[model samples]
Target chain A: MGDFLETDEKVLISLCKRGDLSAYDRLMQRYEKKVYALCFRMVGNQDDAADLAQEAFLKAFRALSSFNGQAQFSTWLYRIVTNTCLDEQRRQARRPQLLSLDKPLNTEDGQLLLTLPAEASDPLDTALSQETEAEIKTLLSMLPASQRIVLVLRDMEGYSYEEIAQILNINGGTVKSRLNRARARLRDLYLKKEELFRPTVHLNRKERRDRL
Target chain B: MSCEKFTKNMGAYLDCVLSGKELSEFQEHLSVCNTCRQEAEELQSMFSWLKQAGELTPPKDLRKSVLAELKKEQGRKGIRSFPGFSYAAPAAVVLIMLVVGNLSLLLPLHVSDAVPMRAAYQQESGTVTPPADAIIYTEDSPDNEQVSEKSELSSEVERNPSPRLLVLNLVLIPLFLFFSLRFQQNRKEAG
Candidate 1:
């Protein structure tokens, strides 16, 4: 399976370099979702994720000549995505803005404008699980950008420490320390929100059993 | 292992990167230490929750939009790689600077009268006189016509410097410095 994927990637890359837009399109189709997922988790916002993911692909295409094939194409693509996200975060830091949490922030005449659905309305959103996810995202955002990137790449994306170090252009020791600090901070946050992380259904089941 | 030592190595231990003697020693500490055991359990649960959060599927339009953007970029690249296109921006900037510099030099000045007055004052006071090559065009000078031409050129440059050139120098110098520093920083970071 690995050999097949590597071969397919090599063929697509050759075609892409030759200005084959269709081949590039096929390559994007293959990895767009994964790239978007990584961006979404890193930035913690859907719109920014989409924008950053698109930028990463665009940058990858422009810099395709420099892709020396030292690493897997996906790894190189991910490094671009990570750098793009970090740059965006740095730009945003220079000009911070306050965001309102309330959805459907306004109404125009009789119609709703900018109506964003609350997590409660999401189909996949169980209350406890959604709360846990939201809390985790909040905690992740609290981390410094360097530590947050390493944590997301390591724990969430399951990239090896070496891969992450390579992606960030840092050494393994720095990666280890950053990941450890991020994990410790997150663990501390989770401890505070332990109630939200508890198994709600199991608790309900036990309560019902006791009542019966 | 001491509690402090265990705490320091807890992350590596949880990642299962510690091996053999250290791993065994950590396990023994966990077995005997209630506080460390609880800490380990909490760290394990937190990691589990993180994994469960999982990857999300991007919006359906993402692929189409990305391809569209890439096509637009490719079109731009096509235009940019055309012959002489790459040098256009730098060439334009240099051309502007040269034109502005020459224009500033050629502009008329109000300093023609002051030159002789300064020269006379310097000679009478036995102070540092103007450069011997700089012909001070006075009413009594032998080469009055030649001195007038040289004086006109020097006076224009010394007295009536173009505001546009001044503004360009002010802006471009700082911009050049800023970009130089930024490039150095980027190189440092890249390395």
Candidate 2:
């Protein structure tokens, strides 16, 4: 993958400027997953994430001519995604909140916490992992949109502090501080749910066998 | 580093953003201090779990929908299609209308037309008679005499065109008033 990506990005960008949809498609395919992931985690919902991602790509296409190649291609893309996601977040905030509307995430073990429907299974994780995933996502939603976005990019996306700052148009120090604060809050929330981190006890021989 | 300092710089240190010297110093301190080491481990675990959360894929239909919207936007780029069409269109129309409306004035009027108009104005005014010394320069005059005669004629026009200015003002003031009143009425109608 790295070898395929090693071709000069400027060449791809120029091709895109010349209306080469294939080159633009390649660029989109390359970053779509990461960008969507960033949007998904930041917005805390899948549908909104998809909308923001598409809008971000369209915005990037419109701005391709104005792109003076001053910044790296990925950096420019990240800025577009960040701005689009933030706009969506603002719009979502204006709309009425639909509390208790979404299905509870599924967990691994048969021991259920929040019940989920038979459908809507995601491929990325097992039931238990999905539960944990959904829990963290909910916790992240408690943060201000700015802090949530910075933390998502910095932590889950593994973006460097400078990259986060560039994407968010903030200084690196602000990125670092916000990440610290966000992570601290996350840790507090995680520690509050002690059962997730603490080892589970097996009650029966059958249960122990199932765990094994 | 004390626990306080390590905690304060934990975000920076983990991001590998501290100065090289400061990083080495922090590491040197970490080698001796157990509390900072433990804090670093906890921070590392926090970020590790976060990273492990992984990505969420967007819906398959989003690309199609957005591109469909973009295709609609292509037509809206009409405003930029012709580089100077917006500016040139109105100007060309106005210029053509002006040339067509006043083509007679732009082309020279014959002496017959001027003589009749002058005679009619004289009869109508009755206040001033044509000057006795009004010498219309003839083509038979010598070149130097023609030059002097033209200069004298120009000087006479220069001294006397104030009457033309006054005549223009007299004709235009009522026109101005009529248009001004019409403009105000149109504005009121619009409001």
Candidate 3:
């Protein structure tokens, strides 16, 4: 967040409008990791996040010419990313079958959780963790796409309340209320899991003792 | 304070949204309510931890894939603006107008000219008069005669259409078809 102001996003945006690919590339280089990370946290998969990020950048590039200087370029880009992710999520939700989360065994996480592979003994926990990720992703999937987006931009990406409101075309108050509700819902969901909830009790004690 | 009131203001306070006297009131409520304070503390920790989840990068091929899609769209746009397809509409309009204008000009002749000219031909050449059957219809007044003759000629034209008009129709119909077909082809190609 601190270094974000150092890059002069407005200058990069002007360069982008002039069709400077290198400038656009520089802009992407600056924001892609954060954008992807936000999508990954929301959608909970590397591939989906990558796809969402690409869509976001492409949309931003196409729309850069029309961008008024009222808002920060990163804010505009965040809006595009948020919309793109929401669209993907809505499309996924309409499909009734469970989506495949399978990845190639070559990746580290994949290597650890290849369900059909013979080497793994505790594949059930591995599969359940993957399912946990999927359930969280699905619960996020269930949120009204707009509210989920405000949460993702504000809570996950660490965008300010003002920025989230501008991106979502809502007022600051709505953004605040929605984000608060989203956090409470997520906290409730996390509490429902015994393993995580019990750990929270221990963690709370440790945190309280540490503060003392 | 009721739990609902504390809960509602709790979100606002955590985001630093409460202002002036509201902040003081919320703090006073918070000091009195351990449950609300604990809830606020938990929310703070949760969001703070979510923030620290490290940055993730998208795979390399994603950009290339999107750029290629954009290039395809640009190419489709180019195909739509191809010259023949652009000109077909104006060309068809001009052709139809030329045909219609030419057909409209073959109006009836005046009876004044027809009858006088025929009579003059008969008298000067000392030829036999035209038969009653030859004058199929007659007008009562001179002016009416002229008008009727012109109307008769136009009726004749309607009865027996002109070869020139036929030729113009022949030319335009194919050109129109070709233009329409070309437009359809261009659309298909663009798609």
Best by DockQ: 1
- Those runs of model 1 whose alpha carbons end farther than 4 Å from true positions after fitting are A97-128, A194-212, B87-191
- The DockQ scores of all candidates, in the order shown, are 0.26, 0.20, 0.22
Per-residue lDDT over B39-79 for candidate 3, one digit per residue giving the tens place of the 0 to 100 score: 98888876664554444447777666766766676676666
Worst ten-residue run, lDDT, model 2 chain B? B129-138
- Tell me the tens digit of each residue's lDDT in model 2 across A1-212: 76556555678888878766667777787788888888888777777778788889888887898899788789989999999888877987899865432322233543223323323546644633665676676667767788888888877777887788888889977887788888787776655555543334334667768878
Predicted complex 2: CAPRI docking category: incorrect
B1-191 per-residue lDDT for model 1 (tens digits):
47988887788898788999999999999999999999889989999888767447777787788678767766866766566543455456656766776555554333454466456545543455343434454555555544555555555545555665677677766665565556455433322
lDDT of 3 by residue, A72-141 (tens): 7777887788778878877977887553433212332222222221222244444334444444554454
Which pairs of residues have clashing backbones in candidate 2? Answer: A107-A127, A107-A128, A108-A127, A108-A128
Q: Report the alpha-carbon TM-score of model 2 versus the true structure.
A: 0.60
Tell how far residue A15 is off in model 1, in angstroms: 1.7
* Candidate topping TM-score: 1
lDDT of 2 by residue, B1-191 (tens): 35676677877888777777878878887889887788678778767666556456667776667556656665544543466544454455545644554443423333434445455534543423343222333344564344445445444544444565455556555655555556455433322
lDDT of predicted model 2: 0.67
